[model samples]
Target: MDLLRKSIERVTPLTNEEWKLIVEKSKRIQLKKGEFLQTQHSFVVYECFVLTGSFKTYIMGENGTETVIFFTFGNEWICDLNAFYHKKQASYNIRALEDSELVVVTKPAKDVLFSKIPKLVNFHIHMIEKANIVLQQRVLDLMNKTSKERYVDFIEKNSGRLQKVNNKNLSSYLGISQEFLSKIKREGEVYNEKAR
Candidate 1:
């Protein structure tokens, strides 16, 4: 709850009444590794704030291949905004990468909060804008960068996640084969050692 308060405060200060309303409306949830927060084609009723551990959002293809869309870690938000806002089914699955804790607020609860605190709506709009920018940058990177360059950029940007996420998932997110990812990592290590 403290983390939630801090997260909100980072964007906008909350009055005691507003904070209390949020606390009363949100619920805490814990998930084990491999557990799903939302499944493909399901309605996403809650918007979640990650408290601990990591989660990945991905889509499974008809050929049984999984494409990683994005990853969210502790102190981040995870939600199918399209589904949550529009009452549509989720197009991707959100699964725990490790045992995780989250604070969740349902649509009704969020609507109530929004009505009471207009600044909260602005905060959400900012978050959505940031998400869009990140997605656009990722798309541009995939379109313009070579695999090795993309891998290097990914490593530089997500240094914290290198050890936490597996190679297979990272490869999928990078739109590269695992073998290529391995080769890139090996080459990177060699380059680093020589530089040192």
Candidate 2:
């Protein structure tokens, strides 16, 4: 619960009463690896805070290929923003990449929170703003960055994720082939040797 408090504190500091109210509204959830947090077309009734573990939020193309859009790890919030905000079905699916624990707040509970705790509204805004910034950066990278450059950035941003996730999944997220990712990694080694 301290962690939850810290997560919220990143955006806004809550009063003791407000903190208690928020905590009372959240429920803990546990999921095994490969479990679906929210499937495509499902309504996102809750906002999830990752307590321990990682998740991938992705969309399947018409051809049945998964295109990952975001990764959520411990201390991060994960939800289909469109579904949660608009009260519509989700277009993306959120799946656990490992056995995970999450704290979830239902939409109505969150609404009550905002009404009762004004600072919480600021917290919500900050959350959405952070997600939007990340999404915009991803779009800019896809449009302007080279595959190798993007791969390098990905590795730097998610330093340990490559060790946890399969290469195929990483390749899909980078919009490159597994073989090409391998090649980029090898190229990095060669560049490192030259610099040394």
Candidate 3:
């Protein structure tokens, strides 16, 4: 509930009544590591606010390789927004990286909320815009950044995630081979030693 209050504050402080309504409408769920929040091809009926832990949203290619597109920690929103908006099947799989607690608002419930609280519209737009910018940066990095550079960037952007997640998942997300990631790590160590 404290996390929910924080989340509301982030979106533009909710009124006491609004907060009460949100609490009434929303449900908190616990997710285990590797648990799916939304599966690929399933309709995303709810948008989740992460209360604790981290998650990765990924897409599986035809060749069966999984490419991670986004990461979210506590206080972040994680959902297939377009799918939820359009009431269509989700394109990505959102999985919890560790045990997590999430506040979930269903699409119908959100619609009711927006009608009651107009400020939510602005919050939704802001979230969408932020996600778009992140996607644009990710695309540019994929095109222009080398594997080593991407690895470094990943480490920089997701320092906590790098510590918690396995190297294999990190390698896949960075679009590099496990061997290549290992080599980059070794090279990084050497570079640090030389700098020292």
User: How many clashing pairs per prediction, in order?
Assistant: 0, 0, 0
* Candidate order by decreasing TM-score: 1, 2, 3
Query: Which has the higher lDDT value, candidate number 1 or candidate number 3?
Result: 1
TM-scores of all candidate predictions against the true structure: 0.96, 0.94, 0.93
Which candidate wins on lDDT?
1
Candidate 1 TM-score versus the reference: 0.96
Poorly placed runs, candidate 2 (over 4 Å): none
Alpha-carbon shift of residue 30 in model 3 (angstroms): 0.5
Residue-level lDDT of model 3, residues 132-172, one tens digit each, is: 99889989999999999988887887776666677777888
Q: Which 10-residue window of candidate 2 scores lowest in summed lDDT?
A: 160-169
Query: Which residues of candidate 1, in runs, are more than 4 Å off?
Result: none
lDDT of 1 by residue, 129-181 (tens): 98899889989998999999988887787788777789889899889999999
Rank candidates, lDDT, best first.
1, 2, 3
After superposing all C-alphas onto the true structure, candidate 2 shows an RMSD in angstroms of 1.3
| Residue pairs with backbone overlap in model 3 | none
